[model samples]
Target: MIVVLLAFTLASFWALIAWKGMQERALAFAKAGSETQGLTHSLAQHASKSFNAVALALFGAGQYILHSDKSARASAEINDLLAQYAKNIPQVREIGVLAENGDWMFSSFETVPAVNNGDRDYFRYHRDHPEDETPRISEPLTSRVTGRPTLLMTQRLSNPDGSFGGVIFAAIDLAYFRSFYAEFEADLNRTVTLMKTNGKVLVHRRDDQVGKDMTGTALFSGRLKDAGTGLYSIVSPFDGRTKQFAYERLSDFPIVISVAVAEDTILDGWRGDRRFDLLLGAAISTILIGLAVVLALQTRKRSVMARMLRERERGYRLLAENVEDVVTRIDMDGRRLYVSPSIEKLLGWSADEIIRESAYSNIHPAHRELIKGLIGQLGAQNRTATCEYMTRRRDGNYVWVEAQLNFVQDPDEPTAEIVGAIRDISKRKAAEEQLVAANEQLKALSETDPLTGLANRRRFDRMFDAEFKRCQRSGSQLSVLFIDIDKFKSFNDTYGHSAGDDCIRQVAGALASCLKRPADLVARYGGEEFAVLLPETAAINAEVVAEAARNAVHDLAIQHHGSPDGSVTISVGVAGGKCDARNSTSSMLAAADGALYLAKEQGRNRVCVAAENPSLTLVRPAG
Candidate 1:
């Protein structure tokens, strides 16, 4: 029975070691898959956008030629334009223009006899099917100019009456794109294939593979039939190895691009790790068996107990050293008894240094008392607590950390210790602070007028409510100045809305300049109207400030064609009352409005005052 038990233990250890090795193999495969899929998608998007831009440029050139006079005198200039583009565009071997009858009319390379292309797939498709306005991509074929393998991009040209004129085509060399594919990180077994949606190969790393029919392939029948981009695996018919494939479709065009990576390439390193773990596990099993036999023969309980304790301590230390968060144990007197080796990475301090210098003393001064209260609470009760605070690092900079603590109790011992794990949360704290500041900026923007850059009505109401409540206690006075730009509507209609906006801005600036105190506020009440707030001013003093505002506007001397005075000006109505229990902000606003109406009735561009007894009178003009 003892021998069988030992054998069972050995088998279990081997199985556990094998499982660990399998996990590493899985991770390696996933890493390869993720990297390949990511790069494949990125390059596909880049290629699609580039091709679309090229197509647009060609379309523009075709449109220009169609509208130009198709005379023999323009032929040289036209062919010269084509030759220049052929030199400028990368990967383009030549450019051609086909007549309406499918006869090649012009070539960028040399003067050649007219060659009929009526049998060509791209030319015949454009001629037969007129509704497909998109650029057609042709299968790989020998270039009619250079005799090199090439892919074609062709677009339909329309006559003046919207009839089919001809086809404008660009022969792009396959060799250029094939060389570009080599820049990617791919092994010998890997493949980059570009084909049409109909599963006709247009370009491939293997030159001979071009123009092959791949419709019945697993990639086309299973993965491409369902999604535009994804992963698929297949056993290579050539090498008999399973290969993982990532594919991306050119969304703007009917082209599918795929990349294949062999599975053996991904798992090459994992096989070595498996062999090493198996041998190590077998050796460990033998040592364990020998230790058990020796302990049994010696029959020493103290030695066995000591060995078990050492093994348990080593297990704990191994677990602690592997993690990033530091584990700590502190005494009731605020001394750190132990800290994991991770402290060196977290705070640039070794565990020994932290224990000798004291952990709590290095906390930020503002947070030290908060941490002490939390620790005291943990000791006073049997509970776990959590906190986030700043801790000073060895470089004298503070880093934010989130700590979860537990009060560890022992039945064999009288004293207790606090055990905790501390994780760096500096990034999270910074994100939180940025979120708060962004919210504040958005709030300010919502309450401000965009045109005049002054406080809007929403901000004015809140300030008025708060100031009204404060004045109810102090029994101080409050004033409201209602201002209106005289003939503003006529001004906009005469000089245009642009000039009207400038007028409003200038007037608002003049009114805001009259208020000297920070507590005072000027807000855009609405179109062509503004309001000023004076916190502790009586009616007489507010009238003086209102006259000053009137003078400031007159001094601007902005010409207004509609105004009889021939200059932009403002009319002000000042109203003041004690903000006691009897008065409200709305009541004061009504008084100011009534005064403003009376001022307009008396004359434009003058200041009027609303007294405490609700009487209106004109204030003398300021110099």
Candidate 2:
């Protein structure tokens, strides 16, 4: 039995370790891919910035030459410089020089005559500005010469005497930037395009739009300004493929450069990483299964050896199998490494399943944090912890289990483990709750009179002590009523003891039912005598309840076994104090008893109060 348990435990531990390792490896692979893409994006952004700087520098240099030397010979020299530089820089396709009268001084095109620039917005914008040396970048406009999408950069020139000259304009070649970026071999599906601020496709990697207008395409226009230079997802303008893209705008220029890569390209290496993890997991699983089988065979061999030696192998096996409690083993890391067969019956989960899941996960949420803290304490040399917690079941119900944990270091492994037992104590807990309820019910019965189900003498005495202390502390008032059956003895003699018992029961019930507050209690003192205790009550109010009780009992007609008339009545003697310091419960009872004697002396059926000197007079009921 020991050998089999050890084998199952080792297999389960190895499986959990393998699972955690695979998950970590997958995360590492994903992080590596993101870092690689970041490097590429950083490089592309720098290259785009370099290109924009080169274009602006060339335009600024050309405008300077035209303004510094103003003669026709110098003008021809400057125009020649512009045409020659345009050919040298691959991105600068066309450059033109215009005089103050709007006649073209030079051009790169072969058959072009002197061009008029006075009507152009670029020319007028530069010419009207007086001292601003900054150049103007025009929104995309159609070029009559090339018929492709184009942006114009105009730099204002000045005469040698600081007077304004015409503008020197240049049209940057977008096709050149697109063609250069498309030649890269990193990802073939990546699309590169240059677009103008007016949502016109200036150039695309497809190369077929050299003279076409692409203003109406959705690819040319969307919400680009809101999402500044970063990764985004949209349909590709060059190939209509949905993809992830990164874009960067040219500083001090009107063009936006974008690079689009398909989703397949971004996740290119993910499948290989997943496959490698699966292979490792499968290999571990096979090794565990083989080890489990070998251990099972060894356990059987050991059992047979024990039988041959006449040892008690069956007894040991039966003891492990039929145990009534759950036994579990946890490693120093607080992971459940082993669980006994009793767990299967108690929690509806097999030992192997419990071992595979987190020990904290199986505990109810209310107990999970507490168990984690206990495990932390155990790790810090508090080697044992005993607690009762709830464990959630497979069907979503929870059961209480009392766990006893102890620490032991395995000789074969470096880490210590907690070996524990969990016993189902749900039945015990329910019995404890029932016992508590029954105790409370018995306490309530102890404070009540059996005959009238009202507060008894003992209850009245307790309440009086409490009320007296409160009144003394708060300077409040209290009252009491001493009541007696006016002719109870004669009635009992005429009607017999059973009728007397009925009369007492009837009178007590009426008095108790008439009192409203929890502080008001009516108790049967002895045969034919009753009392009412009223807290925070004055003498007059106490007399009111006493008189009401007297009348209620007088109206009672209890069936008598031996009486000539089947009836019962009571007389009350009320006494209270803002209760005077001289007055005690015994003194009050004696005075009320004196009033009762007066009522009896006058006639039966009347309530009376005692004044000074112990004189008693009958008090009539109020209308």
Which candidate tops TM-score?
1
Backbone clash count, each prediction separately: 0, 0
Tens-digit lDDT track for model 2 on 1-623? 64566567666666665675666555544553354346445545644554554455455455447444568777566656666657655666777767788887666555345457688887777778877757666765777677776666677777767777666677776656666666752454656666665565665666575434545643345545554455556676556777666665555655555666776665556556656756876686677768767877697786787676445434544565578788777775668876778888899998877787778877988998888787666753676889999998878899988998887765756788788878999898889879999999998899887877767778887887778778867777777777888666777788788867777887877787668688777787767888888888877777767776875675565554333344566667767775557666666666666676666565656777664325453342333
User: For candidate 2, what is the total of clashing residue pairs?
Assistant: 0
Candidate closest to the true structure, highest lDDT = 1
RMSD (Å) of each candidate, 1 decimal:
20.3, 36.4
- Model 1, 111-183: lDDT tens digits are 8446787788888788877787678778778765566877889998878787888898888777766887877
How far residue 494's Cα lies from its native spot in candidate 1, in Å, is 16
**What value does the lDDT take at residue 49 in candidate 1?**
64
lDDT of each: 0.81, 0.68
- Once fitted onto the true fold, the runs of candidate 2 whose alpha carbons sit more than 4 angstroms away are 1-70, 108-112, 117-121, 124-133, 138-151, 158-164, 185-188, 208-227, 235-240, 299-623
